[model samples]
Target chain A: MDIHEYQAKELFTEAGIPVPPGEVATTADEAEDIARRLGGRVVVKAQVHAGGRGKAGGVKLADSPEAAREYASAILGMEIKELIVKKVLVTPVEDIVSEAYVGVLIDRANQAPLFMVSPEGGVDIEQVAETNPDAIRKQSVDPRYGLLPHQAYALADFLYDDPKLVRQATKIVGQLYDAFTKNSCSLAEINPLIVTPQGEVKAIDAKVSIDENAFYRLPRVEAYRDLDAEPESESRAREAELSYVKLDGNVGCCVNGAGLAMATMDLVKYYGGEPANFLDIGGSSNPDKVVAALQIITADPSVKAILFNIFGGITRCDDVANGIVEATRRIDIKTPIVIRLTGTNEAEALEILGEAGFSAHTSMDEVVQKAVQIAAQA
Target chain B: MSVFIDQSTRVVVQGITGRDGSFHTHQMVAYGTQVVAGVTPGKGGQTFEAGNGARIPVFNTVEAAVRETGANASAIYVPPPFAASAIMEAADAGVALIVGITEGVPVQDMMTASALVQDKGVRLLGPNCPGLISPGKSKVGIIPGEITIPGPVGVVSRSGTLTYEAVNQLTQAGIGQTTCVGIGGDPIIGTDFIDCLEAFAADGETEAVVIIGEIGGTDEQDAARWVKDNLNVPVVGFIAGQTAPPGRTMGHAGAIISGSEGTADEKIRTFKESGIAVAERPVDIRDLVKEGLGL
Candidate 1:
């Protein structure tokens, strides 16, 4: 659930964090209007859910409104890591004296939101942590009490020596944590927290990833999803409560559990076949889910065969068998389907499959190997 | 004897009136687990009829359930929103162990609840897990009792159906397990490979161990190092998500490769370095287990 930089800045503003005013434009005309209103040099940043935006030529510093439109028009349809830039953020440029990194994220190892601050900024923090770990100072915040004022100051002190700069940095750190917790974000960062020559601290670039599990509470953050940046199959699968990740392969994997889904995909490669996609039918026992899965898989023309390996626990195998039988009738599935189901009414499942003129295997290895062979041949 | 639970372990079911809770409650009772009490917040002062005349008392809170039934452990099946609080409730009630089976709980909530768990010195198994089964003794959470049998091997996994798949294979191949634990696949689970392995190492009944891990955290690698230095039992390991793409969370929130970290190849390499046999496929686990047992 990665939101665009402009959306993150909006949240940062709401939290009383200082961010340069920016407007998101879906068109070049809109970008030009935004730049003209700002009446100064502006930065046009491509709003795509990916890194390397600068390297992809998706970011440009425009000295005029006409230049802003030109940059936006060029970046709008451009792809960075295969994500099309459908929107661009037009913000007035800032005169920076220095840059620093500040961020907070749910650290799995610490079981809390961990704040990381670095004097080095405007680069991949992961790379920095790897090459020069000492440059980055980290603090694990107690999610119960959140980032205390003193705790924020300790992290802020590492980024600045000036009293005014440290004070602003400390406030920005607390404000970032506020935005992170309020939006149920998994990660929130202000890369290149620039120190203006006028002695002001402001966030120039923002990245925030929302935790989908918290969507039940944060309705506004959930609405920040950009479908234009997502793959069609992925968006469609989400509509059906299925977790899908498309891959360039011939064997289409449909499994019951997440871990099992990955293992099935791995086994497809182990048997010398690439998996077309990773689709988890999840705990939904509805035949419609199976129909949805079939439609999503067959939509990809590269899918030579469909493989379903369901070790039913909470998910019923009979329901899946019925789903396969029902889906084949509902949708004209030309791809050869191979199923391997075991546990939880397996006999009834096998009977349903047999009656539908489809033979199913109970061994995971056999079905994966069979599907891989069928895909390779097709 | 199992690592966590034995025949003497008393159980309390949280969210007992819910769909999954009531269903697994009956399943647990049918398998001879001592499900003494149930909790449903407002549905207290009632009896949940778990067939066979097993009328379990329902309390409004975990505290009352623990006090009334002397329940030492809790099996949680609450909704995602309330699941973390339910875990904290059980921990606050002084339960030694709490097994959370609810999925979709916010990581932030678990972050707070798990920290409280550590402060309370209570063991929380999972907020999204299949729980544990002590083959033919006592079972907690949702592991199917039919697939297990009392034996010398102990199993620890970070998956649901995958654990069932492996345990079923072991049972079908006559390699009965003493207990099979699903520590869960969430990013911030309360227990990890190290905790389960330590419990198994202390348990005298566990002759051999099988570690089932997936791509995500460095928990498996950390467990590998700990096993190499401390434990002496024969260990066979399996790492899922070998072909999974980086950055995309494959089914589990925690099962993702971040910047070339927590990959199956890396975990497998570490397992080999720690002298653990790595099962290339799920079915290969049976043969590997047999080999480890020298059978």
Candidate 2:
């Protein structure tokens, strides 16, 4: 759900937020052309998902179009914080007098939307919070009442000293809140909302995470989903309706729930094995889903073993056990399968597996240890 | 003596005509829950029954079921997209408690639905949780029936599978739960640790409470304060996210980028100050809860 700076700026512009005119260019020649069109003095920013591009030498300033082209050529395809730079955002450089941060999110505890404003911006907000907590002002907005002008003004006052600047800041905060509520954004942030010497406030950078659950209502936003951007196994898992996330290990894990999957990974590591992935088969035990999960795990050559720790409740343990017993036949699982079955029909599940010549354990520790040992051998 | 649903609590199943709706409904009934009515949008006047075909009438809406059968609690199996509307319908019908087992309900919808439910004085447990089960008492939602052993440890967690992990750990460590609730993995859940803490505080059967929280949100801090000020009962807390970083989203859609204040270290420090024992490892939750109870 994270878009590059250029993509975020495109969204901000569509929302009528003032941003410097910019064009995304993949080639050095194209970047120079774009820089010339923006009057030769432009900032070349690497397009990556992560922040701190400037500090990482992924951002550069060009005095002329040729310089922009050189910078673009140097950055293109370069790995910046693990993200390969495919394009560069070339924009007209701006004069900034001050910078501030503003963001909105749903405060679950109070059951209200919360808006935060900090006097200092552009740097990591966590440092500001740790160093000077009082500088950050927060307001919880009632959904029924919405974020009013007074609340925005109160935050704006903290963010600015001059009356004109305060007024402009308040308007921007209002607009940000509008975008947050309307777009179903879990977080809508304007980091380093800059103020030029002319006393105008504009959102210089935008970071947004639209609520994925709200994707049905916002088809246009859902279109922004880049399946290719994700790991191949993950995108494939999604297509199969299995929840899977890649982890930093070699042993592939398959569990029934998110919490259990994480615990399984943690336990694997505890028992001296690195979990390669986190996969949840959900509550259903359809053999097809199991086969799909096995296929995804086996697809990763790093996977030395597979662990199935399922506490079947709605999903009968027998169903999962059967699925595993059946999945091995459908998919060629090169890795060892360590199964832990518990809950409803667990006895039947064990019997079913025992009949199939599969040795599954009732204890989680035993199963996890076995997987780790098997992986170590591999 | 348990919090929320007990054996006497009358249950109503929403979306009971569907596959999951029917399956869990039957399982709950078989586990000895007093399931009195089923609600499906277009199927009114028909009846669905479990054991021995002892019929319970189906209604088109939650209000109709409540009026006809006096069903006061609801377990919703409606899919993610329609879950918000279903919960709203249950709240409108004046169900005292609702447990939504459906996952993937957009956090925004849950936020709005939670507010609406709160406005109507209805308590919601979760949208993506495994539901709540009080052994030999009442079962609502979909926690496995066989894994529970009715005891004094009140369990609460943000993840369904982690709830099972805590329960299994407790079971292995010779600790049993009074009632275990999966608050859900989603960041903006219907209920939080504070709400569950309040319930455990008042429940006579709960000798101690075990809480499992994740990396995002300030709920852990809030719960720590609540446990310190209001509750006399012993509490043990284990906050997840040892390897997690701030401003990074985790598994749950509701989880992520909550800021430095909601980190695991901060929460653990606060909980320690509040006199609650902090479990260093998730597997130690049961031992911590047991020790907190002086067991």
Q: Which candidate comes out best when scored by lDDT?
A: 1
Per-residue lDDT of candidate 1, residues A1-378 (tens digit) = 889899999999999999988898999999999999999589999988889899889999999999999999999898898887889999999998999999998888888899999999999999999999999999999888999889999999999999999999999999999999988899999998999999999999999999899999988888898888778999999999999999999999999888788889989999999999998898768999999999999999999999999988778899999999999999999899999999889999999999999999999999999999999898
For all predictions in the order shown, the interface RMSD in Å is: 1.0, 2.4
Write one digit per residue (lDDT tens) for candidate 2, span B76-189.
998889998999899999999988888888777777788788889888888877888887677898776667778888988887766776787677677778888887777656
What local distance difference test score does each model get? 0.92, 0.81
Deviation of model 2 at A95, angstroms: 2.1
Model 2 misplaced stretches (Cα beyond 4 Å): A227-229, A351-357, B165-177, B228-250, B255-295
lDDT (0-100) at residue B233 of candidate 1? 92
Worst 10 residues of 1 chain A by lDDT: A103-112
